[model samples]
Target: MMIDGWAVNALPGVLVVPAVAAALLAILPNYRATARLNVMATTLTLICALSLFFGKPQPGPYLLVDDLNGTFIVLTTFVGFTTSIFSASYIGHELEIGRLTPAAVRFYHTMYQMLMFAMNLALVANNIGLMWVAIELATLTTVLMVGIYRTHEALEAAWKYFILGSVGIALALFGTILVYVAARPVVGEGVDAMVWSVLVTRAGAFDPALLDVAFVFLLLGYGTKVGLALLHAWLPDAHAEGPTPISAVLSGLLLNVALYALLRFKMLLAANPAAIAPGPLMVTLGLLSLVFAAFMLYRRRDIKRLFAYSSIEHMGIITFAFGMGGPLANFAGLLHMTMHSLTKSAIFFAVGHVAQVKGTQRIADMGGLTETHPVLGWSLILGVVAIAGLPPLGIFMSEFLVVSSTFAREPPLAILLVAGILIGVAGLFLRLNSIAFGEPRGPAAKAQASYVPMFSHLALVLVAGIYMPPALVVWFQNVAGLLG
Candidate 1:
């Protein structure tokens, strides 16, 4: 198989641009220039990611591209680019309000690019160990950003994220080592033992017992990063205290990358017949997270935190869909993952601006949003509707597929899923009713906001619900087949 010359440049370019931007932004003193540079860097990185559709390099010890990761790469880069655009205006206001100093803004942009580099590396790495390293780097970058403000609460949130994230990655490392041990006898030493492409093809010959234990460790480890039920305590705080853009990325990008790593390992498990079926474990955690997060939503006081738990619920649905592991379920899982990423991020963007306009994150303080500020209010309504899995939205289509697929296979489990989703729907709309209608509260002045990024995402979600492109459906179907 021959690789295109341009494809070779594109993969390296995706990483190099952000790495270079992070270095450059660190030294550049002006906040305005740095913001523009952040957007430009992500834009260029997105271009490189897009170029992979033309041609891709062969699998190697260190990196590779395939249909599975190709979808993630494009989604990651596209969202990263749009979020950067939103960040420019969002952070500018923070600077004016003195909430963020120039130095903090500089560090923010630098870390933003660094986070992009790490995520892209994780997506492209062919080595599972190398993928772990990339996720750890991403975790570190976000941990710092979560606490950037240095407030007591911010520091506390960051502290919790760091401790939990560190433990999660450490467990993930143990799991990675167990895999290497299993593969060593078969693949024989060195980097080959840790390379994903090699592991999947050779996994059947490895020790099944070792592989089984390795997956349990891997699931618990990476599941933490995915914000599964028992592992989700750190997520809400991190979202509530971090900058809005960071909240958007945390919900939109980082969690998805973590899930991507889990999916990679899940594929490895699927290749080994004697090993434990990974689906049961995933289903348990996914169902648990969905139910727990749904009930938890009613208790949130902070607007940002409310959406944060919503991220957990949506991720649960995605994990559960994939756990079912058939053509319909996998296709539904793929679509839902993409939809959740877009819809959740769009919600954060609106919440960010809403917090800014109202000067508070407390839900009790915000009321009559639709009457006072029509654009942001209605935008928030659309986002909430999309996220709640309402009809005529992308999430609705994907979720319909998940529920229908589940009912055909497991009626009891389907009941649980439907109940969880309904409980979640009630909680979210309860919050929405108060936030978007009736008596106005607090400041009602016009908000200086970035509507393009928010509206653009919403439009895509709307279009996706109405009609999925033929190319995308084909891509997802092919990838679903591969997941088996």
Candidate 2:
């Protein structure tokens, strides 16, 4: 690939802008100015990401771009931009109510930009070691923000996330080293073996045994961050205790970044005919997470935690779709990933507004939302319905594709997947009815949130379901083929 002049400059800007904004935000002191800067920086980054579609820098030892990651780059930056908008309004409320001090607000904005920078770096990275470093940077930034409240529960959640995230990072590092070792014989020693473009092109010649062991480590390691069932202990607490903006970004963008790393490896393994098939492991793990999260959903008392489990379930669906490894399944997986990101973040935006108005995160305390706060209530209802995979919504279309593709490939597994989806629907609607339609409970002060960001996401998702652009379908199809 040849580098265009515009892409050479633009690609670096995607990473540089957020980092510069973070440094400036740390010393700014004024909440309003810092917040606007956050939005502006994210907007610029999103523009850079979109520009990659027209032109891209040449692949290098440390950085690369392709159809697969190009899509992720756009999705990550777009969500980051909208979430920053939502965060500005959301955090301002916290400052008003004394939930956050000005210093904490500065710290939060700085970390937010840092997180965006890290995720953007991770998506664009070509070297396995560089990618690992980027992911760890993101984890640390989020850990700090998760505990920003300084409450006992917030601190504990941060601690748990830190410990689990450290273990995952360590395992991922080991896996990356093993991969370098595996590729060293074919690609030679040092950086050449670590570059993703080189590794995928040469994977078929590498030793199968080393690749197999390395993949096991990689999947378990990154899957932890992806919130696969047993490794998801930290997720609910992190979502429940953190500022809702962090929760939104965690579910929307961060998990997708981790999964993107795993998918890159999956492609490498798939290229090697001698290597063990990667699908079975991902399929098993995905199903386990989907079913486990679905059953767990009924038990969540915290509203944030409820949606957090929903994120896990949807991730499992995406994983399962990709693991199925066909044109249809891969397309579905891509669509599902995009839909879940938008819908889940929109849900958190609504939930944040609701928490602000009601002054609580407890679901038991929130009832009859339609009566007291119709906009928030109805918005939440639409978000919940879309997430539950109701028809004429983005999730419904993506999930339908997943299920239909699964049935064509394996009937028994399709049944299990459907069962999980239906169970999740029941649990969500049960909660939704109480929250949106019953007698009004708790204080119902009118929310002062910027409804634009939340509704904007929901509107996009709705339009996507009704009709996907031909260009997007072709793009997803090409990437799907690349996965196999």
Candidate 3:
């Protein structure tokens, strides 16, 4: 089969290359060689993902590819590739400081590839069951990596993630089973009931009551992984304690993967008119998350944890956009999701370098960054501005779209959304000014890491804000229409 012109047969390579590279890295003891290999494997995987835009494989009972997930695959692999480059430099510094042994470095590289493989599988899998398994695998790999340093805080964070993550997986499993049971009557008790494409087509005929129950379970379950307000206890801790590269992937890629799963199931629910509207539930949670995280941002002492809350706030906005469920709103949601992924990852990249140079993660100890390290300081300032939803940034455009759309549809909710955004902006600038200006509080050494990945992401976001390519705009609009 062919899509835009490319052969569908190439799809498998995207999955296979990472799995093989991971195995190779597992056995290799040299940190330098394994690090280079990680970047190569991720780059190759990204190439395969990009090829999918040219052509896609036919959907099957266990695997599928379409405009919606095709977009996700590209974004996932691209961020994964950039993060690998950043990781190479970040990990090298850790080695020099004796914070990581050669063995741990090898293991970290292997697990990083494994996490990439699992995320790719989750995005491409056609069966809900397969997707669940893939997400669980990704979670496991991240948990191990988070605790790689074996520090007390690292272990505690990993344990929290594992416990909370396991509960989420179990809830999602039950929801999946309930969905199968709902479909069993119409599609029969077999593989057909588990297929996403098949389920959506036959959704109107399924028991609406059962779907309502299943959706609640699925939302709460996967919502945990999405870092939604109440279930988000694991998020800040994980970001604070894990390696910065892992934190980058967690915010930039993994949360989006979980939300993608929710969107798929939401599409199924929307297909059946008899089912309860999923919009209200999603909007409530999204708004709650935004407000809650915005308030919590003021209390954070650690730089990573502060941005972790920022992640929760942005995810809330994206979730709200999706939940609003119209062509304009959906398009805005997609734009916001893309912008947040790029911007947050870039912020983490800057934070990683700053922490290394200052020898601290404490916000109090990180003053006068601009005076001490102009490039790193200014890069971080740009990232902060973009994330604060300031003008001439991709995030500002997306947030503007969201608020305008919400106002046209729901005025009161729009007010609350604006308030949340303003609140978050206030908190971010307050901390940012302190970090980027003022007298230097701690020793500032020159950064050893490459600035290419961080600056590259910021540049893309800046250009996207100024001028969105016509083809890309059309692609997002097409997918937005599909969301309804």
Off by over 4 Å in 3: 1-6
In candidate 1, where is summed lDDT lowest over 10 consecutive residues? 1-10
Better of 1 and 3 by lDDT: 3
Query: What does candidate 1's lDDT look like per residue over 1-484, in tens digits?
Result: 2448888889998899999999999999998899999999999999999989889888889999999999999999999999999999999999999999999999999999999999999999999889999999999999999999889999999999999999999999999999999999999989989999999999999899999899888888888988999999899999999999999999998999999999999999999999999998899899999999999999888899999999999899999998999999999999999999999989998998999999999999999999889999999999999999998999999999999999999999999999999999999999999999989998999999999999999999999999999998999999999887
**Model 2 lDDT, full chain set:** 0.94
Model 2 agreement with the true structure over 1-484: per-residue lDDT tens digits: 3446777888898899999999999999989999999999999999899888877788988999999999999999999999999999999999999999999999999999999999999999999999999999999999999999999999999999999999998998888989999999999987899999999999999999999999999998999899988999989999999999999999999999999999999999999999999999999999999999999989788899999999999999999998998899999999999999999999999999999999999998999999999999999999999999998999999999999999988999999999999999999999888888888999977789899989999999999989999988999999998888
lDDT, residue 115, model 3: 96
Which window of 10 residues has the lowest lDDT sum in candidate 2?
1-10
Give me the runs in candidate 1 sitting further than 4 Å from their true place.
1-3
Q: Rank the candidates by lDDT, best first.
A: 3, 2, 1
Clash pairs detected, candidate 3: none
> What do the candidate models score in CA lDDT, each in turn?
0.93, 0.94, 0.94
lDDT (Cα, tens digit) per residue for candidate 3, span 128-182: 9999999999999999999998999999999999999999989999999999999
For candidate 2, the TM-score is 0.99
Clashes of 3: 0
